[model samples]
Target: MSQPQADEGIQTSIDELGLPLSETTFVVLDLETTGTSATDARITEIGAVRVRGGETVDEFTTLVNPGIAIPATVTLLTGITQSMVATAPPVEEVLPDLLEYLRRDPGTALVAHNASFDTGFLKAACERHGHPWPAPPVVDTLRLARAVLGRGETRNHKLGTLAAFFGTPVTPNHRALDDARATVDVLHGLVERLGPMGVHSLEELRSVTKPPTKQQIAKRHLAEGVPEAPGVYVFTDANGADLYVGKSKNLRHRVRTYFTAAENRQRIREMARVVEGVTPIVCATELEASVRELRLIAERKPPYNRRSRHPERVHWVKLTTEAFPRLSVVRSVKDDGAPYLGPYTGLKEADRAREALLAAFPLRQCTHTFDPPRRTVEPCVLAQLGRCGAPCDGTESRADYTAHADAAREAMTGDPAAVVDLHTARIRKMSAQLRYEEAAALRDRLAAFLRGAGRSQRLTALAVLPQVIATRPGALGWETGVVRHGRLAASAVLRPGTDPAAFLASLEATAEHVEPGPGPVPRATAAEGELVLDWLTDPATRLVRIEGEWTCPLRSAEAHAEMTHWAHGRAPAQ
Candidate 1:
């Protein structure tokens, strides 16, 4: 694909838009059903004609035994009586043939007068008969007529009206094949009308029916060079500053929607108007595209792309590096050797985890530092209420405070049984005292702690591994990834019949060397690690090699599962 020059200024040639309408295959179809409601209706007749460049290539027509009597009203309207379908094949026997006809040519668009009605009945038939529905791109002639024709040019946007207006040789008479043949002519007429309005390609034709805004129509050229493959896309301003970052499996189709009325978000529409150019970076697979998208959003911090920009802003519950250590919610994890509990997405959840730790241990909540161990003459409210041992006031000895800090560290890193027991006991006591709200609040705090602890343990299990190589079968080949310390170091797609062992060795040799850092995710953000972990845990994934054990503690997993059940109002497993 040729890249557009910077000075072109959005003047798109009709040839660069997409597949031309003249070269596109259209399967114009019509269906006669027993009723209008898809759920309650049965298709009695299916008729479709394949047309290309204003010429018919093939035709398909079939009568289906609905197995249900056709209503008298439906019989009068469609002339498909019960007797006519009694000798015909059932829908199950006819659907496979129709599906095969539809898939005969790839990129064939399904055209109908009111597409929803016909497509709805067909989809319902597929569902009822346990057949897979081939979800095809649809073009409704009625919608096209409404968009292209003026009110004075047509009486109504119905099939018969369109047939009369277009001077079609075949007149629609509510019979499937005849209506289908008439619709083919009507479709050609609408396409002819759209030609003069810059709707030359299939993509433009689809968008033109939406009657896109002026900004959208003007900026449609930005999507011209994007290839239909999985990858990331960056939208930039004229000055080359990043405006937005996104990813899609089909880069061209997804990018084109932004220049059409289908993109309904106001912010996105405004972003589309200011977009000066689009940069497409094609990837080997969808997973690679997702990981790259996350990394780009974090690195660029584009104004239009929300989420993942402030990955470092995540909160962590840490044991503060002070003489009298206490649980504190910090925004970052450093290599200070202090135990960390989480990489929580929200400060509120981190605070809840901290509160849960404080409930179990009498750790100081104050932000004061005591390097020289200065003692206060007056104790704070927490100390007076016996919630704290008044370490600042010298009521608590250094040895006693050390013990509390040790237990807190253990709860954060190792076993959390002490904290769980303390909180559960408090909840039971509060419930017995008829303080339902306080009990509920305590339960929430405990749940939050469990969630953070569980996530931290799961991530640490993967982050501690020096290297892990895994693969899964892809459409064209095998998709493989090299991970180091829970970060995606490298990824590749090996063509089918390629030797897996050799490919794995080559990928590992050139993969990124990740130096171990601190916290749950040693070399990557928590979100990125989670994405990698999801890929690793998929049942289809085959573990080729591992440098270290990849497992979470049984107790931690159980606690997380128990908390999940309790949070959802279900009884915890025995």
Candidate 2:
């Protein structure tokens, strides 16, 4: 079957037409039912009035016959008895005309006191008659009343009580048409109270609240000059101190949301009262915005930004250069000539990576600072169990122990093939002996080593570059940036009509002013470098220009097809 025509369809139009609430059309409806439960009872009468421009456009009222007997309690409450509806048309017979009446205006908003009750019975009736139930947007007067009038202003926000309080022209007396007409008056009264807030649009009316506290309403002007572009924004107090720093794809929407009652964060709600103004720094891409946000939070030490303010606290897995070389988790990557594997999330992950590396190579597992040729020391239990080289005692030669230490360093920072092959051979031997638990443990270690080594290699590769231009697809056009050492030096958007050569010239000038970093590498720099690597790895990203080569000289885990086969227990490639 074909879809119904737009004008004749049951769908309600929500287009605002740039019109105020007074000019918008609303259909106030009411139903007289046999009982409260829609499933157990039936609608005995339907009453509706369509109001537009503060005047009635149309009114519809009809008696509907329920095939079942009406309960006596319903007759007393609603005055709609079986005798009154005995000769009326059944609900199935009246559905077509009712839908047509409701859809007379394509852009109508359906209204009722407790909307769910009437709309529920109407929806069931339409579904029963095989009519396409176009789900129209609803405006519940009960919610509107509670939101607009405080408890002291009205006795209780019931239909009859509200109508009496407003002195509506029509009084509701357990009758459908009278109740609907009274509801129309109540709607207009509520909207009249909302006019001062400049909430003229239907969308605004649907979300309107009682006049907000003076604090929340006064801060609305802070968002007036914010742009509809990707950027980082700062909220500052009256004392010129940073309260919060945030980033968003749309600066205007994100900043404005903070000044509304809808903001549930107690801290932000308190911040709104003190926020004097917003400062927006537009960026070429959201990636740049995120990097800028991290930098601003770290520098300004904003009280509201608790997460990324301490990137320096992240831990790294470091290999010590002592005589008995072993792994240790350190807070910073110093200039000490030891190979570093992370900037991992925390000490726990760094420890796991250290364990994986130790599983493959028998490096000294002791905590002691070794004095070579000291015969007073005994070998630790790990040395007797073959988990470490017995360098504590004189059993392992210096040359032999140095070679093993170099192999461990090579696996983490150089080739990685030595550790990869060792774990592979161990896993295979365990499987052959039917030692499944041992084999599984070896495979997990290999996976952890691969994950850490791959990330470290990629980050280290990007962190050494002097300057490069990276581009990714965006909604407006190509989002491009010039990155120096791992930091975003300058950024630009290359739209369709933009001159590519001119864009590069401006970017190069900006890059020149930025002291090109082969700067001290910190955990913060590594975290930002991950963002750059993500853009570079995308197949769609085009490297428009480069001053230095981007290379991962060491073999990446992604290069080995057989590694995945062995990891997943699949047959090796032919």
Candidate 3:
């Protein structure tokens, strides 16, 4: 047996989606067929190379019997004559081996010069043979070449042209294996070209060819100076007013994507056409970038950003301060000590949470404003149906209603044990009865309840913590922040060898410039609270100092198997 040929300069790792270039496995492939049209043609030969972290790992090359005459023109074009494939295995045999080789690793990405052409033939072959096809992530070097190369760089985008342009050691000889080897070189070359532009992951590489509109292409230079690091970016019009604000781990790549077809939103395209320049604020971490993006959108109220533009729009499920105390979805959180649960994304989610709480607790359902001394009142339907205590009709005592309200408050702000227990039993009963739709509805309510209650408990815990400093390691240095009463007070980048004492002193100085208020809650907006929660929960971040205890007495009601069974509507694991 002969050893497979190896390609060079392919090993380097840049991680995205937790899988880096160095760790990824690629299968570069090519096919020679009986004709140009995949619909009419049959594959005569298949060639491929498997590479991992820049080094060639394995090679596959085989001639396939097409069970059709080799046209003279096709033979002349590919140099694969009828005699060459006379004794070779059929496509059915060759396809299984090719698929098996590709499946040797989980992170394998299929690379081809014109991927659709080759992939089309392979898919047809699989279907004809009744064999299952694995549709792995495909990277088309032809599309990538167009995206990376300028018009003057290549005469035309062709496999041989690219092979010659990149100076690959092996030239394509119209043979399957030789062309595939050349394509492997081209793939690596294009990936190297894309690295600086922040094309580091499989997802980015696959979507690189989404061509920008003509208007967007002209304004592409606006992203020229954007850094390739986690940060928030603002797009501004000619008048220097902000048009749109976004955050990304790779600022340059993300900003560039706005001009490309990858950004499909019409509003974004309109914003892109008017964008004159970009302003980026480099942050210590992605969490910081996300928080800054939310705050910027809220402050600027840019027309392009729909979400986070109006933090006040997010509804909260609040227990009213009225004597009856009904559960209602309200927009604002008051300074008064009433139990509030949410920052829910919309009215629907808040209503779902409210319904779940109502199902579990018997609180007043009427929307009446009552005075202490009233005449005979007509009871509402809920009161007549025994769902309520008939507080409106004055049949229920104020003390009895108060007790029910307290239970609801506990379910909303503290332990959701009452709500969780109720839903779990209902879900189990429905599941046993095979009432799938009802079970699903009950499951959704339970999920909403737990989500709201958990968020409230988390916010309450963080709000009570007066002062703390959190730190995480980043690309440049340590990312440090001083959070007072759960609101960011100060943030700084601490370079190594710089004295910790000096950094802390400067951080304290910056803290004086910090905005006041932990607010009435731990976070003013849902986004802000989410950022704090992410920072606090990150296993990598260390708490350097604290003025008060950071703790929560309440726990999420999701410890039960019911949630696990019904989440995503999947059947429970045996």
Candidate 4:
């Protein structure tokens, strides 16, 4: 089997998330402080024991002059008086050595009985004295003991109670070093208890105390087969029906997160309860994973996926193919050859685009279909208002009505200068007259039209292309994709040191054959086409070959992006 390559800037290995407890290093530490509140406390002593595989490797102990009087209550508790630390180094001097000890072993997790109390004082000291704190992974034995041991097994989860229950050789004294040593043994005891519960890895150990739902725990096995790589994952039910579809750069890590308490989304938790299996489809790059995820969600319409499941529901402003062409808001694009202005996600935006086109050109806005030469019926109030050419009556000739339809089509498909210029002039006139609200409304309508027009133009540009081959550098080799008609036809990773030309030839031969369809994005959904466009326009992507022109209209949405920003009551980009 071919090993999956890591996409650039992503870690595609499970090592970090799957490091076994036996192979993990832990620095069990305790701090003696003057007060309980971390913000008000000052550390007087620090004690730590570095251990791996349940064996002690080294120890760190220190006394620091806290530069503040040690409270009598604290002194009574820990027994280290001010005079005891009087000749000792100040906290500023002690922090460097302590930080060094923590940094000596990379990937070492910190362990403590009441970890927050200990870590808080140390972090406060490091911050006060201007020493950078090494924020290591922390394991709180107090929380772990509470999570693992029953009340019948232990009276309390205190350090002394746990140490006595575990029968550790070292008992917790008031002093820091003895307490740290006792905590280490307690940690080992907790680990032993967790082992049978399947908490074997350090990552699991960290989140085990919080505990996932029983359903999540039972479904964890679903993540076992997912490799750590950029991919799309589908969670399916017992009947093999898709429940949810997701994409991730690290499939193993992301899938495992769902079975941990870290994944707190309530909907996902419910989905986890019914998830019978996970299907992982590895890809050559993150872009391909994203595209595939979009395609799968659209195809399966999974219950757990809220977005992209209803691409067919996307609204479009279509110029109806009738005797008198009028703008119509539609749910789906068909191969009827009528020009469409959008895959608009909202009906209101499509209406606004339709209104903007009608405002610019005197096209009929009514749903009435005319059979020909002209009707003798009375025109609606819109004709008297001059918003319509009154094609329903004999007032507007067929040739003149056809001219308006042609201009509207040009604005929707080729160039939007007429619509944009008219809206701009209207907005300027309204602004000059201090009718700002009406002007803003017109601006919104104009922006909606431009947005749809720009998107339609961009997608049409890519959809017309017969083929486009692009590549970008990946961690293991060259990440490449063959796109035809705005859809991903094939994708692969050319291993490093391989001949690029030969790989390209092989990829082109095996690429999926896509027959061009009608509308903006023929072979794929608009969302998928947009994703492909994003990948193609990425600065890192290089065009290896192109079968036809791969360019947007000279005056598409991008050209007026700043103008739209200004229209939306914001300053244009500098």
Most accurate candidate by lDDT: 4
TM-score on alpha carbons, each prediction: 0.62, 0.57, 0.64, 0.63
lDDT of 4 by residue, 295-382 (tens): 8998889999887898888899999889888888988788888999887888888898899898889988787757744456788999
Instruction: Return the candidate ranking by lDDT, descending.
Output: 4, 1, 3, 2
Which should have the higher lDDT, number 3 or number 4? 4
lDDT tens digits by residue: candidate 2, 119-197: 9999887654436665555778988889888769988999999999888999997788999999999998888887885
TM-score of 4: 0.63
Better of 2 and 3 by TM-score: 3
Backbone clashes for every candidate come to 0, 0, 3, 0
Report how far off residue 51 is in candidate 1 (Å): 29
261 in model 4: Cα distance from truth in Å?
A: 2.7
Tens-place lDDT per residue, model 1, 482-520, is 999989999999887778778888999999999878779
**Weakest ten-residue segment in model 4 by summed lDDT:** 565-574
**Models ranked on TM-score:** 3, 4, 1, 2
1-574 in candidate 3: lDDT tens per residue?
9976542212122321334667789999999998877777888999999988888998999988775668999888888888888777767556768999988898688899889899999988876443567767678898889888998999999998999999999999878899999998998899899899766666556557753456765676787888998999998999999999989888987887666444545687777778898999998777678778888999999888876788777778888878889998888777667888776766877887899889988787777786555545798888877888887777998899999999898777666778777877888887677675677578667666676666677776677676678788877788888776656776777899999988987887777333324323644466676577678679999888887777765354434322343322222111
Candidate 1, overall lDDT? 0.81
Per-prediction RMSD in angstroms?
Answer: 13.8, 18.8, 14.8, 16.4
